[model samples]
Target chain A: MVTLIQRILRGNPTLFFVYVILFVFFVFAASTAPQFRTVYNISNLLRQAVAFGIVGIGQTIVILSGGIDLSVGSLISLAACLTSGIMIGNPTLVFPIVFLVLGIGVLVGLTNGTLVAYLRVPPFIATLAMSAILQGSVLLYTKKPVGGVTRGFMFFANGQLGAIPFAFVFWVILLSFFLFLLRRTGLGLHVYAIGGNQEIARLSGIRVSVAKVAVYVISGFMAALTGLFLASRLGIGDPLMGQGFELESITAVLIGGTSLAGGKGGIEGTIAGVLIIALINNILNLLGVSGFWQWIIKGIVVIVVVAAYKVKE
Target chain B: MLVALFVVAGIVSPIFYRPQNIFNVLQQASALGVVSVGQTLVILSGGIDLSIASIMATSCVFAAALMAGKNSMVIPITLFCLAIGALAGFLNGIITTRRNAPPFIVTLGTALIFQGIRFVYTKGAPFGSIPSWLRFLGRGGIGFVPASVIIFLFLALVMEAILQRSAYGRKIYAVGDNKVAALYSGINVPNIILSVYALSGIFAAFGGLVLAGYLGFGDNWAGKGYELDAIAAVVVGGTSLAGGEGGMGGTVVGVLLITILSNIVLLAGLPYQFQQIVKGLVVAAAVIFYSFVKVSGERR
Candidate 1:
């Protein structure tokens, strides 16, 4: 057991922190709240996890490329704003409408990629500008929340298959596919190479720019899916719904053990990280910690985790 | 040419430079300008402080609670906010300098954490009433020169003197432009990074104070999107996002340009949402065009 533990810690910079947090939260939850142990709460946690878990995948991809994309949350908000108010509720449009929402996501991602990849504009500036554009565009589309998405849309957000929420299933399947792609393919290798060292990757014949654009495209697609689920579940999509999800997604990715400087992250780590964050939120709420301190504690956790990694390095 | 555009804007709408509206713009812009000033320093040091919005919001809540709570404890909270801001900035430095964490990611992570901290303060709603005196700082002017603008002017001069004449400032530029060369020349890169974040924090806290003063009432929502505005203003003002180019003057112009653009939007009676769209377009255009110009200049 000691050797195995040492192996895990040696392999992952964030393993120790994640272990401590997960173990503590589990113990606390089990001891203090008997209700937390039930299958119902476990499913509920999975359900909550799926929402951010999906978005966290995209954020990890982008961050793994040595860049941060602030525009994902805005993209989610815009996708929600576009789909929820009219199409799902109108009953007039076909699946073509969902295509339109997804199409919009691609366009947004493409714009970000083109500017950053082609124009030599910094990723931070390009995404930040795009976020502002999406935020405004969403406001223009709907001043407030719109209540409607096709009844069929609910299948993605709240439906259950053999007791598992469809959302959780979708989240898992999506993540598994990406995990495979990350480890088994040339695309994954290129992404890691670029993130680890862009200049060397360029020297090594990797199309560093293309990988970056691809990352944002993946980010945009996931954000769109996240928005779709929220719309399906809430039965209403507010233009402002995605205001903080960007940070949340990024935090989950970081907590999952991905290096911020890029090139050294994986989807598998993010899964654990997402679970850690989701569990932390649940435990904190259960502990009756005020919302204010919830933030303080969350910040402290991220700092400690990252700081620990730094010290270890 | 940009100066002439400003001239034309003033002519297109007399309100563009009206004393009252100008005061309003200056007061409203002070907080962002303060944060941008800090960002300018960091960017020059080849770093970016993405947490300015969070730092500003944290300070905003701290100041609001003080003024509204009217507790003699206001000073400590203010200092506390300032100290916290510096620590946050210093933390960014430590990650970047010691752990060799990239400033971009360090600040980005801290920014996310800071957002949560701000959310906790209000949980949704901000605290405290704008004291009359503080409110005056936000809305009133002294002898026709607004207090916020005066503070902005004072800050600009101080920043200018430091950036141009101070050895510390010279070291920052050297570190930013090329760290390896600077290190060979005996510059302490990590210490410079540390001081940059500290100064950035100080400036950001000052901006938060101006924000609290001008805008009465505090909530977790304060400075929701100011970081983008700041980066936009900083970049538009001709400060290179690449670092080692431009200074406080460029940021001032950037702030002024955004101010004019917003004033024109309001003058047109367009919805505020449109203002955001316009800001987005303007930032993209400015950055893209500025780079285009720089490239052409290089070719020349």
Candidate 2:
């Protein structure tokens, strides 16, 4: 039991930092605002975390396989636009629209995968270029925001089950799926093998390129889901809706103890990381810091957290 | 050559390659070229400074806030903004090199923080006025060229010299090429990385000022999406994003390529959507060719 405890402590210590930050934020939130304990407020926070958490799942897969996806945000915007068109037109279309959105997401992911795997394009540049294309496409397709009677979509999106938001359920479902994929399957082991040593994985016949493609596709799917979620929540789809989400999703993944170098993260850490970020955003709101100052603080913390994690490693 | 494509367009339309149009291309490229200089430095060291856009945005906001007048605060505040940018980069370096974070993650985190700071300062909406004294810097020019463009060129040349001709430049290449080998040679690799990022920060901040001045106003999003553009420019210019190779000269070409394409596409009356498709194809093609060249060269 002692050895197991030590193993847990030694194997992953980012949780400690997360705990500390969580504690600090909790106290800060309580002290700064008397209404920090409202059920509505707490649910709001979880719902918000759902966005980053779900997207981070896809991000985690890509990062675990030694890649990054900057195009996730733009994918989100596109997905939201596509799905909203169908769902807002009639509630009956929601189910079909979800698949359509996912399909679009998969296509985007495959494009990224093809470039990274077959052509050997650098992940950063490839995804970055993809993002630009996606953003520009979003702007060109829908010149302005698409607003209508999206109450059905928004109702389902914002609905809560026993204080757990509907989006939170979606996040949980994704987490369960990825967790299974990462633990029970040969694919999981192969991802680790590739991330740790690409040449050896290829030698082992792990189909490294296919794996790379799969992860990016998963990322695209998640990004699309998030975009759709944002649309449902916003009751409209804005062309520039997911403008800076690439940075945020990437940040969450990093903060979750996933190494940007790839092959070094997990779902649990990502969940924690998402909450940590959500908490930070909530506290900033509570503190009423200038949005600019809040940005500065978040940047400093991310830099510091990443640096600290590396130092320990 | 893409130049042939440009020439064909010029032939098809008489004013396509006119001096005025080409100058417009140069003007557009100038701002990105300035920021790309810094990006070039960080990449050369095998580090990615993703927070560059945030730093640029921060500088834009601060510079606009300080555009109260050409009082004693002008020069000092300008210096302060530059220093802050360099300092932000320094912070990025410490985490990346000293603290052991991947440069990508460290910068990514800082990018968020800086973005938040911009939002907070502006309170979801930032409105400001540029002082009359600095209007010339932002709008006026010496003869025909924009003062901003001139500054962009000057910075690019200076940075190119520093990267290619200077001892520090050599060190940066050495570290990027092989940190273990560099450290064995007793090079302070971490310090060098820090310095390069710091320098990158300064360039980003400088670019922010140019962006603000040229636009004659500043906002939290002034440099929005610029980091990606600068990165694309550097890569298209034939600078290996892998580091330890390429320089400002190539980046200049890349920036010009993008700027010119942006202009020419508009001139061709291609809608923005098709223009994006074209841009993506061009970048995709560039990446494929670049990969082919690098991969083949490595084999040989």
Candidate 3:
């Protein structure tokens, strides 16, 4: 056990550091807040973490490919609003809406990819513009919560298997798939290469543009999925549902040991990062802290963690 | 592009060309124009300040809260607000440079922090009103041109000269052009970045004050979307997001272009949604155009 721990410490200090923090915080929360230790609250926490977890996974991929996606949050808002707006609590409409939202996601991702890869627009500005466009479109559609999901759709968010939320299970499945892709695929290697050095990646014959586009596409799909799940859980689509999520997902990715500059880090630590944020939020909620404080805390945490990573370097 | 935009605006609505309306547009552009100047400086240093909007909101509210409609409190409160802005920028700079964190992430984090501070300070309901003197600075005209416009134009010219003629300005371009080269050349890269951010913050605070004066009241969302607008203007003005190229001249034109576009939209009574969509399109289109220009230029 000692040797195993030492290997992990030496190989992936960021992963180890994050896990240790998560473990300690978990223990503290469980010990101090009886509510936190309760089965219902634990399940609730997992459900809450699902949004960040799913989106952070996508964000991780994009960052690893040397780009960022500010459009994810707006995409989520559009997806959620569209899902419920079209479904209108009708079971028959659910599947169609799902495909439609996913298609829009893909299209938006493609636009972002083309702009960044082909036009050479900076990722920050490209995604930021996409975000604005989506936000405006959503606002034009509806400024308030509109439409509701069918009862069957709620299973995606609220269904459980032996006390574990179905959303958590779905997230784990997606996580496993991405982990496999990143650790054992050519595309994954190309992504890392592109992020490490775009010029070198191209010279080395990697389809850098294709890989960049693919990561963004994946990010878009994941964001759309999150929107669907959120709409199901809330039972209604809210135009403002996805606000601040872009920053939240980025914060989670950064905390998970992913470098914002790209080419280093993986999805493995993102889960812990998601949990850390969810756990912090849960503890604060249980302690009767206002939500405003969470923003301040999250901001400080991001800087401190990134700075610590810098120190390590 | 400016002339073409103006012609388009005139065709869209004759009201756009009225002297009174034109001054109104200039006044509206003043705050954003000032903020974009700061944003221009930061971007020139190869750094972005996402926190400027948050800083503006914080300073706006802080200024109003302190001034509380008292003339005697104006100078002190104004100084304090500028200090707050500088402090926020310093934090952003320190984290970005010293900690080796990306400016994008650092500014984003500080944006959240400053926003949270604003919320905490006001408990979500900001109060207080701008004094008459400041209000005049925002709204009152010195004959044909608005005072705010004059301030904006004067600052732009001064900054233009500084960028064109000063050692500090040359250092900014040097640092942005190539950090390692700048370091080897004995330029203090980190200090340059730090001071640039501080200057950006000070400008943002001044812009916030102008905005507060115009509105005559404190608002938590005072500069909510100004960061994007500032960026859009800066980029549209021909400043490269990659850093080291572009100037205040292009920025001024960009600011005027954006302001006029919005003014035309307002004159035509278009919905707010259209304005946002157009803003997004403008940013994307400008960047794409610039990239093509750069690529073709390189080919030559």
Candidate 4:
């Protein structure tokens, strides 16, 4: 058993351990809470994980390219603010507003990428500035929550087909698409290469700048998507919507085994990471723990998970 | 450029020349100025401390909780708050250095932890006014000079002298410039990094003290979002984000510049929202401007 465990550890250091811990937590939660065994709760858990999971996908791409996007949460707020502010329960405005939000996402992503790839600004600093700008703009636009979400918008988030929520379906679709892109595409290969060694990747004839730029653009789009879903669910656009989401996504990515320095890890790990977080949150809510305590627990979990990986290394 | 800004402020709003306004700017700048000093040191050592705001917030809450509106509790409560801040920094440094973790993530995590503690302690609502002494430190002036400004200037000068003339200061720069090279030269790189983070925590705590005093009370919401302001000031001061290329003098100028710009915006009667946009733009522009200058210099 020891030898088998050692072999599995050698084969993939990050994935297996995090998975085991996740499985353990799942079992523990399932046993402790009777509601945890219900189909309703399971679907709810998956639904809760969707947004962070989606954002985590984008974060995985960026981290794989040796960059981080702190602006994602703010992008989410921007998307929520813009979409709900414009749509205002008008079904006719939905399509145009969606396009506008995506366009803004692309624009912000392009600017972020250009700063990092072309101007040599550190990814953290560039995205930090971008986040500040996005957040400040959103706050400037609306000092309070703007309500006017359409029934259709709410349905998009809260609706389900048969036994499954649309959110879960959306998360699955995003998961499959990104997993394929990361595992099967040339762009994914180059991303890993650049993250592993930027100079080597450049010397090896990869268009490092293009890959970096593309990843950030994808990240922005995903964040916008998350924002849209968030607005739909809340039935309002809040300037503070998606506050601290960047950290949450990063925590999920890190828990999933993605390295901050980049090159290693993928979406599968992030999916599991998101599930772990969702489960913990679910359990806390079930136990009636306060949000403040939840924060402490989440913070400690991040440190512990990171430290665990460090120990293995 | 800073002088130009001051002159522009005078031209734009006659209130800018008012003694009260000047004192307000000075007092306002001092809180940020103290935090920026420690941020400069942390960045100088090739590290970033995202927890400064959290530390400040936590210290403010801690001090307030302990004092519970009592004057005699001031000194002891202040020391306790500072100690907690230092302890938090020490933990951050240890985790980052020993585990080879990214300073950003580690500090980010620690920030959450500190924030969590504060929230749990305050239960989302903090009460208790500050002591009269602290209130004076926060708001009172001796003659035309604000007490906060005096404290800020005194700390800034001391830090500047240390960074210039102290051996420890040079070691910090050396470590930041190139850790491997510094390690080889036996400059104790880890300790320097650790101490810088500790100092950042202490300074942020001090800043929180001033802020608490300024408000004359403590609240859970105090010191929220000051991290970006401090970082913006440091960067605008011409300090490289990559570290090892800035000083306290530059940070002071950056702090003043930010304060004055906000003052101008307010004096010009712009909405508060514009200030956020401007701050975001200023940080981005400052970094871009510096990077372009560096690129041109390299080519030459």
Candidate 5:
């Protein structure tokens, strides 16, 4: 037991620190707030984290690849609106719409990838433009909430598997798959190499453009999945649903010890980061703190946490 | 390119040539134009200020709440707002430089904090109005040209001259071009970066003041999307995002182009959504076009 504990402590100090913080906060919240300790609220907290976690995974990949995607939030809005608009409460149309939305997500990602890789556009500018385009398109499609999903279609987010929410379960599967890919696959190594030093990576014969493009596609696909989950949970397509998510996801990734400079972090820290945010949000809500204060707290936390990492370095 | 856009706009709408419409576009351009000037400095120094919009909003609200449409309160409040803007930028600069954190994330975090402050201060319902003198800055004109336009053009020319001739401006370029080299050359890189951010904050605040005066009221969402717009304008104008390679002259043209494009869209009676789409396409296209020109120039 001592050796096992020591191994974890030595393996990834950042990850251990994050989990420790999450645990301490969790215990503090549970002790202080009776509602927070309840199984119902705990499960609800997990549900709330699902959307952020899903998009955060994609953000992690992009950041790991030394790029950022400002378009995920807009893409989520588009996906949600498109999913419900096409479904329109029809159970029969669910699968087709899901596929369609996911396809569009991939297409958008491909465009971003091409711009960043082939055209050599800065990821910041490329993604920002893509975000604007997506946002405008969504608004043109519908300024307000439009269309609804059938009750049966809600299972994507609301269903239960044993004691676990389906969305949570889905998130775990994704987390595991990405973990395996990053830890075990050649593509993952290439991602790190590209991020660490693009010129060197190119000299080493790594398919730099392909890897860059792939990360964006992965980000896009995950954002679409988040959109689907959100649509299912809400039962309607909201044009404004995905607001603030791009920054929020980046916040999670940064807090998780993922360096914005790239090639130095993992998805495991991201999960803890997502949990920490959800926990704070839940705790603050239980404490009757207004959302405005929450925003202030969140902003401070991001700076303080990143600064702490810098201090450690 | 500016002339081409003008020709196209005139062809699309006969009213585009009207002096009244031209001045209207210039007046509308002033706020964003001012904000873009700040963004240009930061970008030139190899940093981005995502917090500018929030700073702008905070300035707008703070000015309105303090001035409260009183002519007597204008000078002090305006100075106070600019100081506050500088302080906010100083905070951004401190964290980003000292911690070596990405300006993108740091400024983003600061943006939220600033936005939260605005919300908490106003309690979600901001009240107050601009004074008439300040209103002249935003909406009033000297004959055909708007006062705001005059301020914008003057600022642009001064900034351009500074970029070309001033040692401080040259230091900004050196830091942006190569921080390590600049440091080796005995430049106080951090101080330069810090000062640049502070300048950005002041400019953003000034932009906010203009916006408030034009609107005649305090609004929570007044500067909602100006950060991106300013960035778009600066980059579209031909300032390289890579830093140290572009200048105020290009940014001025960029601001004008963006404002005119939007004006055309409005004049053509297209939906606001189309304006957004076109804006996105233009940013992307402009970047692409600039890079293409650069690549060809390099090859030659």
Candidate 6:
């Protein structure tokens, strides 16, 4: 048993850290916040994690490909603004609006991917600029809160089958799909290969540029999905709905054990990281900790997690 | 590019060179100039500091909380703010160097933590008055020159000298260009990295103090978006983001250009949103242009 535990840590230190922190956080929450382990609160926590977890999955992909996307949050905002403005509670407009929002995501992801892969712009600057552009565009779209989410659309977020939230179900499906893709597919192999060494991967004929673009497109899709669900959940279009999710998602990815340098993480780690964050957020809320200290604690977590990873390395 | 911008601005709005407007530009550039110098050093070391704006905000908040409008408290408050900034930077530096964490993530984390602490301390709205003398530093001028501008000039000169002539300057470049090579040459690479982050933190605090003085009030969000502005200046100044290939001279030019561009945008009567879009595009253009130039130069 000792050897197995030692081997597990040796093989995947990130997993060890994530799960250990997650368990400890759970225990702490259970001990400190009486309502924290209640079923309703647990459901609410899972729901809260869904949007970010989806975006975190996208971030996981981008990071795995040796790139980072700072535009996810803005992308989420843009998606929410556009879809909410266009849908306006019309059941007929739902399909078209969703498609259009997802299409915008594609265009954005392509722009970022092209800049990085073809024009050789650094991923950080490219995505950061993209973020600014998206933010600006959202502002231009509307300065006021947009409303008109149809009951059907709201159901996507609020409706649950049996004991499960629809959003959680969506999250699970996306998670399983990505997990399968990452662990059992040729595309996944290429992603890891490219991140491991682009030059070598390119020499080995792995279509590095295409893979890079594809990953960003996936990330964009995920951000859009998150935004769409967020708008529906709120039942109104908020231009700032996903204002800080980019950092949060990235934090989740990093905490999940993904390397910023790329090619060294997976979805499971990201989910663990997300759950841990959500749980802590839940506990903090239960404890009535002010929002300011929450920010401080989160920042500390990101740094400490990364530092731990660095030390382990 | 600087000259071209000046020429264009002159063509479009001769007011761009009006003495008062020029002073305004210089004054505006002054705050950014201080921040960019620190940014230049960090970029030179092949790392970036996203926490700069937060550090500035934290310093401003601390100054407000400590000085409480007392003239005599100014010196002590300022010193305390600088110390806090250095401490924040020290945390950043130690984690980044010892743990081998990427600078971007480390700084981003620090930025959030600091911003959060300031918000918690101030409860979202910061309140306090600046000391009269410090306000003079931010808003007052000595003999027709803004004191802030003069401070900026002095800082520019000193930092330029350090970057161009000092042994430590050479070490910074060496460490940035290749850490392993520097280590092989027996330089303390981690120490250099730590010092750069610390210096950046100190300057960010200094910039925050000036900004607070200029505004004559404490604002938790005073330093919002300044990080990008500083970065834009550094990039425009021709400092390679990849590190080891730029200096304060170019950053000064960059700061002037950015200040001028924003001034023009404002004068053009565009909404604030467009200003952001333009800045984003300008950064993208400058980065692409630099890469293109580097590529063609290499090929030749």
Off by over 4 Å in 5: A311-313
**Candidate 3 colliding pairs:** none
Strongest candidate by lDDT: 3
In the range B250-291, model 4's lDDT, one tens digit per residue, is: 899999999999899999998777777788788888998999
Candidates sorted by TM-score, descending order?
3, 5, 4, 6, 1, 2
Candidate 1, residues A1-313: lDDT per residue as tens digits? 9998888778874656666777787788889987788888878788778878988998888888877788988888888877876675666663766788788877788788888877888887788888898898888888888768877776778788998888888888898899987888888888899888899999999998888888888888888888887888787788888876886787788777788778876887788788878887877776788776766676666556666556222
Better of 3 and 5 by lDDT: 3
lDDT assessment of candidate 2: 0.78
| Candidate 4 chain A lowest-lDDT run of ten | A304-313
What's candidate 3's i-RMS value? 2.2
Q: Which wins on DockQ, candidate 4 or candidate 5?
A: 5
Q: Scored by CA lDDT, what does every candidate get?
A: 0.78, 0.78, 0.90, 0.88, 0.90, 0.88
True contacts kept of each: 0.44, 0.76, 0.60, 0.53, 0.57, 0.74
* Tens-place lDDT digits, model 3, residues B1-300: 899989999999998889999989999999999999999999998999888899988988998888999999999999999999999889988887898777877888888888889898999999888888889989999888999999999999999899889999999998888888999999999999999999998999999999999888899999878888999999999999888999999999999999999888888888888778889999999999998999999999
Model 6 stretches astray by more than 4 angstroms: A1-13, A311-313, B11-15
Which residue pairs clash in candidate 6?
A: A89-A148
lDDT for each residue of candidate 2 in B1-300, tens digit (9 for 90 to 100) = 558657866865667767776666666667788888888888888887777888988887887787654445557767988998998898888778777777766777777777776677677666675555445555556767767678777888887898888888899999888888988999999899999999989988878877776676768778776777777777788877677888888887787777767777788777756556556667777879988998889999
Fnat value of model 1 = 0.44
Instruction: Report the Cα lDDT for candidate 4.
Output: 0.88
Per-prediction DockQ: 0.45, 0.55, 0.62, 0.59, 0.60, 0.63
Q: What order do candidates take by DockQ, descending?
A: 6, 3, 5, 4, 2, 1
Model 3 DockQ, alpha carbons vs. true complex: 0.62
Q: Which residue pairs overlap in candidate 4's backbone?
A: none
Residue lDDT tens for model 5, B144-220: 98999889889888888888899999999999999989999999999999999999999999999999888888888
Tell me, by TM-score, which candidate is best: 3
